[model samples]
Each structure stands twice: as C-alpha cells, then as structure tokens.
Target chain A: MAEPLFDRIALIGIGLIGSSLARVIRRERLARRIAIATRSPETLERARALGLGDAYSLDAAEAVQDADLVIVSVPVGASGSVAEQIAGTLKPGAILTDAGSTKGSVIRAMAPFVPEGVHFIPGHPIAGTEHSGPDAGFAELFEQRWCILTPLPDTDPQALARLTNFWERCGSKVDIMDAEHHDMVLAIVSHLPHIIAYNIVGTADDLETVTKSEVIKYSASGFRDFTRLAASDPTMWRDVCLHNREAILEMLARFSEDLSALRRAIRWGDGEALFALFARTRDIRRSIIEAGQEVDAPDFGRHVVAHHPQTPQPEEG
Target chain B: MAEPLFDRIALIGIGLIGSSLARVIRRERLARRIAIATRSPETLERARALGLGDAYSLDAAEAVQDADLVIVSVPVGASGSVAEQIAGTLKPGAILTDAGSTKGSVIRAMAPFVPEGVHFIPGHPIAGTEHSGPDAGFAELFEQRWCILTPLPDTDPQALARLTNFWERCGSKVDIMDAEHHDMVLAIVSHLPHIIAYNIVGTADDLETVTKSEVIKYSASGFRDFTRLAASDPTMWRDVCLHNREAILEMLARFSEDLSALRRAIRWGDGEALFALFARTRDIRRSIIEAGQEVDAPDFGRHVVAHHPQTPQPEEG
Candidate 1:
C-alpha cells in the first residue's frame, strides 16, 4: 500500500491485544517482519501456530533486538517485568509502546527501563470484548475505536507521530492525554464497570435465596449483560485492579456514594427521582450510537452484506 | 392454520412486548382479528402505521369488545386503569392476560376488574431489547424465550391450556409460576439489573471530573454493556421499581451486602477472593450458551441467515 511503517515490529506478550495488532499489521502491511514473544513458551507456540509473526521467541530481549517498534501487551501488573526483560536489547531508535489498560501504572512500570533513544509511550486501546487470548482477537477489533496515548514530558514528537500514524493505519483514532487524567477517566468508564460487573455477578452467584438455575434461566433481562463482563479474563482484570488502585478506589467511592443515594430513593419509593435519573441516562446510549460505537441490530444485518462478498445485498429500505 | 386460537385478540398498550406479541400472533395466524389499543393516540397511530394489528383504537373498552382474548401490555402503574377500562367490555369467556414486568402488583391491580366467567391470567414474556415502541418489535422476538404465566387460584384449566398453546405457537416455552415467586425471581434477574444499570449510568453522568465525551468515547470497555440496559424505557422501569417494591428491596439488600463484601476484598487486596468470584461466574455464561439462551457474536452472523430466504446456507463445521 505504502512503505511499511516499521522495518521490524516486536510484539511482547501475544494475548488478545497483541494478536489483534499482529493481524491488523499483517493485513495492512504495516510492518515488514514481526517478532512475537511472551513469558510463557506455550503462548509463544500458540502465536506461531496462529501465524501471527515472522519470528517467535520465549526471550523478550531476543524479540526486541533490531525491532523498530516494540509493543508490550501483557497485563498492567506485568509491565515492569516485561520492560525489565527487554530493556537492554531494545533498539536505539525503536518506539516502545504498551497496550495495558491502566496508563499511569504502565508508565510508572516501564519508563524506568526505557532506553534513552527509544520513545516509551504508554497507550491503551479503548476497545475490547470480554473474551481474551489470541484466538479471541480479530483484524477488525480496532476499527473505528479510540486509542489514548499518554506520552511522557520528554517524549520525542517525531516518535509520537510515527506511533500515532501506525495506530491510524490499524484503524484507530488517537487521542493524547496525561497519564493521570487517562487513568481517572478510564477508571469511571472501563475499570469501574468491570469491577461492578464482577461484583454483581458474584453477588448473584452467592445468593442462597435465588437458586443458580433461576439466575441462569431468566438472565436475558439484564443480569446476562453483567455476565459478559464478569466472564472477562480474571487474571487481566485482577491485575488492572491491583495496578490501578488509586484511580479505581476513587471511582468505586464515587459509585458507592451514588448507589447509596439511589438505594435511599428506592427505599423511599421516590418515583420522580428514579424517573429523572433513568430518563437522563437514555441520552448516553443515544450518544454512543451516534458516535458509531455500536451497531443497531437491524442495521447490523444490512451492514453484514457489505462485509461478506459472497452475500447478495438486501432490498433497499 | 390451526383453527385460530382466538376469534379476536385485543392488545391493550402497544409497546415493545405488546407489539411483539401482535407481530408473532399475526405471523402464526393465532388470531382471526387483532385489535390494538394504547392510552396515547400517537402510539395507536404508530401501531396502525406498522400494520401491527387489524384494528387500532385509543379506547381500551372499544378494543376489548367482542375479543375472545385480551392482552394488556402496559407499564405496571397503568395496569389498574387499563383493567378498570376494559373490565366492562371483556367478552364473557375471554382469556385476559398482561405482559407487565411485575407480577404481584399486576395481579392485585387486575384481579378486581375480572368479570364473572372471564378467565384472568397474568403473563409475561421474558424477552425484550433495550428498545421500545411498536417499531422495535419483530415476529421472532418471542422465539425460544420463556413466557411465564401466573394464573389466579381459580383460573380455568381449559383457558390456561389454550393460552399455553397460543404462546407455544408463537415459539416460546411456557412456565406457570405463583405470582409472588415470579416477582421474587424477576426481582433478582430483571429489576436488579435495570436498577444497577440505571444507577451506574447516573453515577457516571454525575461525575464532576470525567467529561461526558470521555465516557462516550471510551465506553467500549464494559460501560457500553450497561448502557444498553440503562437505555431501556424509563417509565416502564420506574413503574417496575415502584410496583415490585418488597421483592426488589429484598434483592437489593442481598446485592448490597454481597457488594460490600466484594468491596472489603478489594480493599484488602484479596486476589484469591476476587479471582474465585470472577471465575465462578464464568460457568453461568457457559450454561446460558449451552441452553441456547444467547447467540454468541460470531454465531449471530450465521443465525441471522434464518431471516434471509434467498441466501444459500454456509456449510456447517
């Protein structure tokens, strides 16, 4: 299409996000050669089997050698260890980035070990499904999604532009923000939702009065929605919580306070208060749809034809 | 098709559930003539525009006249008034039912209006999307979903059988449950989830620091799932909260207690407790998939094919 963005790209930790980037990079010819590595040999093997990279290695240091770009896609808690593993071998002019959910912790974890010439930018893709691992990713995962970059004060402008261009090529819109602000924003939008989901599902599971079978059978109402989030990778989310403690705790405090007020309203049978709150939240969903974050089911049916070359188009509406 | 189940079917309150039943009943030829009635004339006109029924009216009394079956699908708060309006016009042997979310209050509100010899059976189709209104319905909305019937103590067996057969024709599995039990079960499954969703969205909206644009932009993580449930009809959900007071309050108490325990675990950084709870909930999702309750996203692409008759089938793996 155009000259490849990077001569060689090294992906350290080939999980859902890494594999997805690998697929997108390969599809768009964004990198000439790709090196995949994870701490676990089995995962490295799985990446090889998936044909995700030109080279696969269990040594993160070996993987980043001579790479023009290195993306660390491990859990937030493991960012420091991954950085430690690859620190000495990182190429002089390489762009070092990460796909950790928490920006502040990732920056704190990796910034210490980043080579002087490397652009160690902290980034988080504001998109993911509940599913995890290599098989759960697809090339379209990043399409029309946001990717936030938290560049350090001394970060080179040219390195930032190159990395932003790479993400753009992978079908993501990029936004730059301070790591602390990104952490605070994501705590409310992403981290807190996952925490609340896990909490609610756990609550339902532990209920002695409401049998498990009943919960599972009648879940189509709303509980099922929480289940999808709760079913997310326990290790990844647990690491997110552990790593982003301050932001998450702050969001949780706010959420609990607000929930208490709601509980009080419900307890007092305040219909007007409940109605007002419920009415206001409807706009958020409208905003999400307007922002092109989700597909309306009927419209999705129509759009599917555009994706599938074999399928004939539906009659005009 | 099978000697029309009812001579005439009157649907009072044309919203998502009501309009869906109308569509399915028409598709399956379960009723000879359909009479649609809603309190708002605009909704009645919209139902007519959608060809949702053979006749449309604003008068509940007029709609129920000579109808062999009457299905009231209004918010729980409106159940009493709808029952009062249609009580005088129900045919002598009409099987009267409702599709309200709350069961105990609906039965309490509707039971007083039952004319002698009219079989009053309160029912609910445990299926819906976040969308409302007549346009949000489809014939297959009820397919493979559970339709719970909470018949009164002195309800006629013959009427129950006929209604069960009617729902079966519309492609739903039917269950008969006591009104109180149904309320409690639904309090955990439906009401709590909606209330939680509404609360979380409200919490996010009220955040002094996080901007609305930030919430919308980064919503794909987990918050977007809650938005779908939060976007549900405010009036309907408000009525559900007010009407199903006792069961909902009880469930809320349990949910809050469990949530507090989770908060404690998180505060203490108990990874084992968090991981254990998160891991356990994964089984429920598996059960739901196994029970054919939800279509996984990948499978949804294939399942949508059932609607397109012109498309050739993809080979099964």
Candidate 2:
C-alpha cells in the first residue's frame, strides 16, 4: 500500500476492537511492527495463535516499549489500569489513544498517566458486533464506520493528524469533537440503547404471564432485534454504564418520560397520539438509512431461512 | 403442489402482510383463485399492476363473495370494519381468519360480525419487514417463521386445521393458543419492543445537546438497530397499541419498572449489578438463535457494503 505510518504500533488488550485493529493494520501494512499484549494469559495465547501481531507479550508495558504508537482497546472500566501499566513505557512523541465507548471518563482516567512528551488522544470507533474476543474481529469492521476522536487541549496537532490518517486507512472517517460532547452524544446513541436492550430482555425473561419459552419461540415478532444488542459483551457494557453514568442517566430519564407519555396515549386509546409518534420515528430511520448509517434492506437483509444448532427442536406445549 | 387448500381465497386490505400472502398463495398454489381487496384506491391499483391476485376489487364485500377462505390482513384497528364489510358476503362453510398482531382484540372486534357457519379464527404469522405497502411484499417472508392461531372455543376444528395447513405450506410452523395468551405474549415480544424503540428514537430526536447529524452519523454503535423496528408501519403499530392497550400497558409497566432498577444501578456505579443483568440477557439471544428465531451472525448479517440513496456524500465539516 503506502509506507508504514508508524515504526511500531502496540495494541493493549487484544479483544474484539484490538484484534480488529490488528487485522486492519496487517492488511493495510500500517506499521512496520505490531506488538500485542493482554493481561489474560489465555487471551494473549489466543491472539498469538491468531497471529494478530509481530510480537506478543503479557506485559502492556513491555509491549509498548519503543513503540511509536500505543492503542488501548479494553473495557471502559479498565482504561485507568491499562494506562498505568503502559504509561512508563511509551516512547517520547508517541501517540497513545484508546478505543473506549465513553470519552470523558476515558480521558479523565488515562490523561494523568501519559508521559510529558507523549500525545494522548481519546477515541471511540462507533463500530462493533455483539460478538467479542480475538476471533470475532475482522479487517472490515471499521469500514464506513465513524471514529470519533476527542483530543485533549495541548495535544499535538501532528499526532492527531497521524492517528486520524491511521484510522482513515482502516476504513473509518474520523471526527474531532470535545470529549464532553462526545460522551453526551454517545450516551444517547450507544449507552442508552444497550441499557434499554438489556433491561427489556431482562423484563421479558422475568415475565410471569408470558412464559420464557413463548418469548423465545415468538421472538421474530420484534423481540429478536433487541436481543442482538442485549447479547453484546456484558463486561464492556457494564463498564460503559458505570463510566458514563451521568449522561446515561440523563438520557434514560428523558427516555422514561417519553415512554410514560407513550404509555398514557395507549392507555387513553389515543390512537392519533400513538400514530403521530410512530410516524415521527419513521422519518429518523429513513434519515439514518439515507445517511449511510443503516442498511435500507428490511430486517437487515437476513436470509429467508437459516438453520442453527439452537433452533427449536420441538413444538411448544 | 398438492390440491389447493381453498377453492377461492379472499385477502382484504392489500398492504405488506396482505400482499405477501397474495404472493405466497400464488407461488404455493394455496388458493385456486386469489381475490385481493384494499380500501386505498392507489394500493389497489399497485396490487393490480403487480398482478398480486387473480381478481382485484376495491370493495371488501365484493372480493370475499363466494370465497371459501377469507383472510383479513388489515391493521389490528381495521379488523372490525373489514369484518363488518365482509361478514354478509362470506360463503357458506367458509373459514375466516386474520393476520393481526393482537389476537384477543382482533377476535373481540370481529367475532360479532362473522356470520354463522363461517369459522372465525384469528391468526398472526410472526413475520414481516419494517417496509410497508403492497410493493414491499415478498413470497418468502413467512418462510421458517411462526404462525400463531388463537381460535375461539366454538371455532371449527376442520377450519383451524385447514388454516394451519395453509400457513405450513407457506413455510411457517403453526402454534395454537388461547387468544388471551397470544395477546399477552405478543404484547411483550412484539408490542413492547416497537414501543420502546419508538420512545428511544423520539428521545434521541428531542435531545438538545446532541445534534441530529451526530446521532445519525454514530448510529452504528447501537441506535440504528432500534430504528428498524421504529420504522415499521405507523398505522399498523398504532392499531396494535390501541387494540392491545391493556396487555401492552401491563408490559410497559413491567418494562418501566425494570428500567428504573437498571437506571438506579447505573446511577450507583454498580458495575457488578449491571454486568449480571447484561450477562443474563445474552443467554436469551443465544436461545433465540438456537430456536431458529434469529440469525447468529453479527449485525443481523447486514451486507458489509450497501448503497442507500440517502447516504451522506461529503465528510463532516
């Protein structure tokens, strides 16, 4: 492709996002050398087995030694610890960025540990699947996705450009925004959806009148859509909820108020009110589809039929 | 295929569900002659242009005249009017059923109008796309999905068996349940998800801090998934909420209560509580996939690349 952008790139925490970065780096030849490290020995071995990097280690500090760029891809809750582990090893002038869902919290967690000469930028790639771990990653995960960078004040402009270029090469369009604004936006778009999905699934599970088996059997009705988000990695989502608490709570409060009003409309047989809201929501989906954020295909273009091992084997009694 | 299930079949209300039934009926030879009717003159013309029926009419009564099987596929709220329109024209020994989301309400609305000797059964095939109107119809929409029939005690066994056979031939597995049970199950699995999706999208739209473009750009994170369900036909969903108000309200209360607890957990920074709930929900998705109710692939198996007419053409400023 092009000449390597960085002499060495170290990835801390080899999970879905980390491994996906590794794949894209290798595919695009974005770095002359790639070093990967994870605290979990099993994950480290798995990443090694997957050949996700040129060098692998259990120590985040060891992995970042002499690396020109260090990217952290870990649960939002673990950002501070990862920053502490690798802070001393970053080469001078090296760029350290993170792929976490919450920007404000992540920036607060890691900024203090960044060495004086190092450039620390907080970034979140608005892309992922419900699946996790090294094997779940692919080079194409970031294609056409938005990667939002929330650079701190005094951050080097050259380092920001280089990181943006790196992400652009991996098939992402980068947007620079204030870290606080990023958290608030993500609170509505990301955190709240996951929390709502998880809550609804839990509610369905706990229903006494509607059996769990019936929920599973008839899920194609609408419930299955929520399940995809609910099925996302628990650790990552938990961290998101904990880290982005204030913005998420504000969004959730607004959501509850709106839902309550909706509930009232249904209670009062206000078909017009329900219709108006439903009609209004329809335009948003159209806009999202038009904006290339969503597929226009109905049902995300799922095949008409697919057989899976978990498919119901017998009729419900 | 085998002998036609009905000598004449009338489908009243030629929207997405109705039109889809028309296609599948033609493809599978489910009816010797298919008669389609819609209240909307525009839709009637579109269905005729698409050749979706052997006979087309704007009058529901005229369409059902002499038909051995009458299927009312309008919105749940329209079931009563359609029943009133076609009740007097139903042939002797005809089987009348409907594909509506709320079985209890549909049955309650239509039961009084169904003429004696016309076996009245309520049916809901748990299949569809967010798209609506006659042009969105496809022959395979019902393939491998569930079709639940909530037949009254006085419902004819032979007529129920015939309807079951009809759905089976269209590639759905049939489940017979009480109308109330069907209403409650669907209230949780179908009605609530759409309501929640609509509410969340509305919330996002009303946000003062997050620009609409920012929400649209970053939707891939989690928000886009909900938009699909929220994009579903407003008239249909409105009818669902109006007709299934009690069951839906009950589910909504439960959902709100559960969501409140989740909000508290997040507010308290209880990562363990959030993690436990998050982890529990993943199993349901796995079970749903196992039950053949959902796709196991990530992002609902969306194409890696898809072109939309509304896709953004320029990078953000």
Which candidate wins on lDDT? 2
* Model 2 misplaced regions, further than 4 Å: A303-317, B307-317
In model 1, the runs with Cα more than 4 Å from the true position are A298-317, B298-317
| Per-residue alpha-carbon lDDT of candidate 1 for residues B231-314, written as tens digits (9 for 90 to 100) | 898999989999998988888888778877777777788888877777777888888766666645532332223234455532
RMSD of each: 4.4, 4.8
**What TM-score is obtained by chain A of candidate 1?**
0.93
- Residue A11 alpha-carbon offset, candidate 2, angstroms: 0.4
The fnat score for candidate 1 comes to 0.58
DockQ computed for model 2 against the true two-chain complex using alpha carbons: 0.53
Error of 1 at B216 (Å): 0.7
Where does model 2 sit among the CAPRI classes?
medium
Model number 1 iRMSD: 6.0
Error of 2 at A106 (Å): 1.4
lDDT of each: 0.84, 0.88
Q: Please give, for residues B36-147, the per-residue lDDT of candidate 2 as tens digits.
A: 8999889999999999999999899999998988989888888888899888889989989889988888888899998888898889999988988898888878878999
Q: What is the lDDT of residue A298 in candidate 1?
A: 40
TM-score of chain B of each: 0.93, 0.95
Tens-digit lDDT string for candidate 1 (A1-317) = 69999999999988888998999999999999999988887787788888999999989999999999999999888999889889999989899999999988888888888878888888988877777788866776787789999998998999999999999998899999999999899898988888888888877777777788888888877787787788888899888887777888888887778878887888899999989988999999889877877544542332223224465433210
